[model samples]
Target: MEAEYLRHGVPLADYQLTKADHRRQREAVQVHEWVQRQLAEAPPWSDERWEEMRQLLGSPTPPWELQRWQLRLYCGHVIEATRNRNSPRPDGGVCDKKRCPDCGLDPAVIVAFEPLGPAAEPPAESHSLRSSRSTRQPPADRRSKAELVAENNALRAELEVLRDQA
Candidate 1:
């Protein structure tokens, strides 16, 4: 029975590995073809294209544009204050003073307060597949094990035919 699974003087395991390699090569070729199609369809790079790319790469809001107050604690530690947060005064009178993130023992003096800007937009794309997988709601496959095995066998036969043609 095991001898029947041999292909062209090759062991069943070796044959299976070759078939798997072919499948991987076919997938890589498909990805290259898709990229070629995209390049062919895409417009040539122009100033507008550069600007679009820049916007895509750029942060939605500049970091320096945020309402930030540089607070200098009497303990010589510098900390930043954001919007709606209590800022230390120069005279150490308004809000909570002597509240340092590092020391938390001395009066904090407001060094500089900048003009506030717009809120930052949420990121367009996730950094990684693993992180995005949690947000992706793919449909559940409820196929039976037998049905899946039958489909796999059919695909394998089809692949064999394709391989022979190639």
Candidate 2:
């Protein structure tokens, strides 16, 4: 049956298709119908032309559902193939800048670049001390302690001088 043929011909399982796939399939069928109508309306064409049209309709190809599936497969393959190829080196954490290691793809083929920096390293104890010191504030009660101390010492010295005079 036609349904059986369509089911069998799909590269992926029927359940795997997303809603987008269904929409694409519907659009493809519409386009196919339009093409068929256009071909029918045109004046008698040569055998070669007819054959070409037939080929367009018959192959594992087109009518939208197949094209969408093919595109999905192609995209997935490219992503997986390039992922490892473009991965950064183990020692430096930097990916090879010149070429892909796995596929030998040119630098231009990679859409994004990721820089690998040094691996995790703990901060020194001194670093935490510096941070804490920078954030500390003086107690509210001792806010003017330095100035008060200086004033008290001056007053005491003056008293001692006055008492000496007495």
Model 2, position 67, has a per-residue lDDT of 11
Top-lDDT structure, candidate number: 1
- Candidate 2 per-residue lDDT, tens place, 66-115, comes to 11111122111222122221223211233212233445433312222222
Q: What lDDT would each prediction earn against the true structure?
A: 0.48, 0.41
TM-score of each: 0.22, 0.23
For 1-166, candidate 1 gives per-residue lDDT tens digits of: 0011111212222222245434544554566568789999998999998899999888654432334444443344555554331222222244334356887542343222332232243244533544678788656877778989999999999999999999
For each predicted model, how many residue pairs clash, with residues at least 3 apart or on different chains? 1, 1
Error of 2 at 111 (Å): 24
- Local distance difference test, candidate 1: 0.48
Supply the TM-score for candidate 2.
0.23
Candidate 2: list runs displaced more than 4 Å: 1-11, 47-166
